[model samples]
Target chain A: MQEVVNFIDLNLIMVGYLFIVGFTGGLVSGFIGSGGAFVLTPGMMSLGVPGTVAVASNMCHKFPKALVGAIKRYKYGQVDIKLGLVMAASASLGVQIGIKIQQIILEKWGQAGSNLYVSLSFVLILVTVGGYVFYDARKSARRTDTAGEMVSNLARRLQRIQLPPMIHFKTADVRISLWLTLPVGFATGMLAATIAVGGFIGVPGMIYVLGASSLIASATELVIAFVMGLGGSINWALHGMVDIRLTLIILAGSLLGVQLGAIGTTYVKEHMIKIVMGTIMLIVAFSRGFAIPQYLAQLKLIEVEENTIRILSAVSFGIMCLALAVGAVIILAAMWKGRFAAEEGAELPDKGSSLEVVSQES
Target chain B: MSGRSYARRKRPYGKVIGFGMLTAALYAAVYLNAPVVMTYFTKGGVYAVLPIATVFLFSYVHGTFAGSLWSLLGIDAKRTRLQERMEKRPAATRKISRPRPRLHA
Candidate 1:
């Protein structure tokens, strides 16, 4: 009795949609330690779910997935639980504040303006950060034919800060001021509220700004993701927006995907992780970028063809899928090459220069 | 720390039965009488119990299930290998510290 897509009922065949999206999105999350949500919410909406239900269900599913991923990484000694928790606590606070600002815009200008604001944020932040990560990864890949170098001068400088209350993060292998961490974590939550994908900022912030290694940053992100997702879901669930069926189905795929991705982390080098994270972020940014014009039209900045809008939305979703596909390929290929090389030798641990951090956990 | 010790321990059947019963009761409360459960869960009141309880429940049951299920399927992460490769996360860790040269020079 629910709405259909292409003559298919959203409520009925939703099971199939959930399974595929869950599996592939989970695959991406496992590789990058974040990003399944970017795919999940939109995938559900495409099945004719209300925007509220899609976001709520996605959040509901996210925490458990992150929890599982975190535990796996912990066993790998990649998670800085203390750091993740601190960031999570602050990020949740930021989420509330961000939500308040979103509400203000929504109340004042209504839905179109709110949607425009979110799309614009997504386009803006993703483009800036994602493009940078992608470029860095490409450059490093060229020099050494490996993917493990840190290109962010910012992280190195942050590490040199000698501010008070210095804290040591074992997995991250850095001792930095606690104050520096707050802004990164807070920005993560704010962006999460604005665009619903905070890891795009969180992972980069941790690696580049906070001076944590890519491996630890990606893994620790699961902890922060768990906290934020749980908090958001509860807020949304109180409104009956979470469809438990939808949440559970996605979890089925994600659980398996997270396990694989977690194991993958053991086999890859450090920089490869950044490569995957940056690649996904840039592609997703582009996906959001395409939708900006449509939202602008809604705000009457310009009037474009309705067919053009529909086509653009379709293209955005396609790019999102392509992002996931590319991530999976990078992870698999890197791991394969590593395993082959490791087998021929004495399993010599690749130096910091040659390691891949992100997918090694998977 | 070794897998050998883990292979020796046996959990009591009574404990397993008790846990199963508690889990069954929870499912009954949430799924069987969903309308009544939904009443409190979706209230959106100041109590905040509905959403908090749901996350707590999922975190426990589903979390454990995913963990053990992966182990059961032999999908566990390789501990020794991971210990070697884990660097501070790739995002924040500075693998390089070379400063840029000044253009004026």
Candidate 2:
């Protein structure tokens, strides 16, 4: 109890930091479906909060934020409740398996090894997946008249499979075999448990595999995040790890940011979602990459001075913050551009008076 | 535009202020009694419900306030074609497509 109390010594600066990060993180999450945790956990730890407490509090704040975001997006007709529920169920199961794997690694290689494993996975996954998404976004941006997200060939083939118990997701407008959804959901869960950000995999899976538009895929991810975060928070709370003070402060900023982000979606082009997501992922990968040397040094695989390791760690944290800031800037700028275009459209004659400037690309 | 959307576009400052006050009071109560709140909240076991339930309450009140505030500020979702399609999504009664059986020669 004393140790916990000592660890939670919050002040004005700490409160402001958490609130700002929370707002930016919430904005990105609302726009891209899942993010902020990759930065939030470490940000809290840097403030002297125990890692477990940071994670628990972050999880506590996440579900409600996601719930609010989900409802807001659902109003805009973006969320597919059925698909989200299905993915959530599978993801729950995958989380347990992912935790088991972590335990095994922890028992064998200890903390340094576990950290190394996580960093390597973060870099590899982010680079490969982020690169693909960014490339696709660029291709889509080049073509001005492409109306909505084009279904991928892989998704088309998967939909053709006549496996039993096909599910029709109304919002996503994709009829895919139930069997196909399981692996994607499972992988999403595993990644979430492993990396603390499952939407990284979940949104992309829904987009490239399930054939959902990026808009629907990102919106539906909030549902999955809500379900997963709720369950995870309960487990953490039961263990007495959640710091409600931290949770509430984050909620204060995130609630406003989330609603703003949700509305931003209705204003922006579809490809903008992919662009923001891919950019964040790639930057975050670079951020994680910077920390690899320290972990390697800890394992005695490389000799490094303490000062150099400290510098690397600080660099990594700065880069992660850069990722969040970049995402927030893009969303805000896009929203401003969209609003300006709408006002311009409103001034034109009745024939040109459209509520949405759908052709406006940034 | 949907009537509901049009109605939403008209700022409802009343609901926003009402929820905003309640949310502020709730946050004040929790923060003012931080010592007692922390001791009880971290007691573990069934007492875990306290934090969980508290968050749910905050989310509902605060979330509603935030939504209204955004609407008041004219940051509402636009009536895009995709959004319209979503709003008028076909009822469940719509025919479900089944895979056509194919026979290999």
Candidate 3:
């Protein structure tokens, strides 16, 4: 039997919806380096595109977007290419393992089981990681002297270990054991393969565990994303799963949004990246949690009315969109404020200095 | 820098328009002949290269166009004096602790 490609008919409205979503997703991705896919894949599926095609097309768009972003940041002297390449190599291996595990689960328990596993992983990883990032950002925001970037305690401990073959990351300005860097990259690749949004983990891991600044971590994640996305896109393309039309249209919008988002990074403080990332992560975690019940019901793990399940699914999707929108809003608002402050010659106080100055003046 | 001075920065209008037209033409061709392109693209074998190549082509052409378009609009990264100083500074070094061999007790 010949397999039919499920391509959705594109009306003007659908094109507009995709463009807007792509732009917003691109904006978030450019700022953080890994968020656009989390929104884009689900957005495409909602528009009647099949799950496989949506994932494939999103992957197709991701590499190009990441490539463009990486180039832009590299010019800004933010990207550490050597670090990015090393991480990417290990991440590619992790992706293979992740895909194999996904395939095994699909074969064992079918679609419902596969979905439940994905959701469970999403919820578990996002909450723990996101909560910690949020707490760290808030704590950093409250400090009185913000002369330097705050290195996480874990990262400090990791850097102290006298492991041989410590490769120096010049741009990120950290020298750590090459062995420690592999796990961060591998975990990034694994999560990326599983969730289609690996940057969330990759960026945070670099900052908190590896001691890279938020700027360098976010910029470097684009390199990892580019490598993994290219590999994923090739695999999907080989299966004839990519819809070129969808990929191009999304790319058109993202190309513009991503540049803006990358520029946004320069105007704002480093902690802003963490704030946006943590906020989006927590919200998306909640959204996935909302969808898990329906998958559970499908697996006969729980009994729920069809109407309630439908409502839960809709809310889950709505929350995902909301999370992306909230992230975009925060990025744009901060960028605007930063730009305005710069233009007016109103030098913004360093992160923790604002409160101290206000008290002293009073 | 004042807004006027920033606006005076050279804009890549020529590159923007040139790539813009090329991008538009490519998009038009794809949309107009969607069926044929779709058929070949989904053939699922050696033909998979079509979609992959097509996206890479669009990204390069259109990505350049989008970048120029933003520069023309005066939406750019702020090159603050502080940022310049930070970029010029030497890379910070971390103290590497060497492991000492313990004598046999």
> Which has the greatest DockQ?
2
Show model 3 residue runs off by greater than 4 Å. A351-362, B1-4, B80-105
lDDT string for model 2 (B1-64, tens) is: 3334545467979999999999999999998999999888987779899999999999999999
DockQ for every prediction shown: 0.15, 0.32, 0.30
Q: Write the per-residue lDDT of candidate 3 for residues B1-105, one digit (tens) a residue.
A: 445566678999999999999999999999999999999988777898898889889888999999999889888887643344347767679677988888999
**lDDT by residue for model 2 (A122-180), tens:** 99999998889999987766643534456689999999999989999876778999999
Question: Which segments of model 1 are wrong by more than 4 Å?
Answer: A1-12, A142-152, A340-349, A353-362, B1-76, B79-105
- Whichever of 1 and 2 has more TM-score, that candidate is 2
User: Who is ahead in lDDT, 1 or 3?
Assistant: 3
Ranking by lDDT: 2, 3, 1
User: Compared with the true structure, what per-residue lDDT tens digits does model 1 show for residues A36-57?
Assistant: 7777888878877778778887
- Write down the DockQ of candidate 2: 0.32
Candidate 2 wrongly placed segments (more than 4 Å): A1-7, A346-362, B1-8, B89-105
Candidate 3 lDDT score at position A116:
94
lDDT of 3 by residue, A137-241 (tens): 777766625443577899999999989889898767788999999999999889987887888889999998898878788888889888888888888888888
Q: What would the per-residue lDDT of candidate 1 be over residues B1-105, giving only the tens digit for each residue?
A: 233433344534454355446655665556566556545554554434565566557556655555565455444443443465554336555677789887985
Comparing 2 and 3 on DockQ, the stronger one: 2
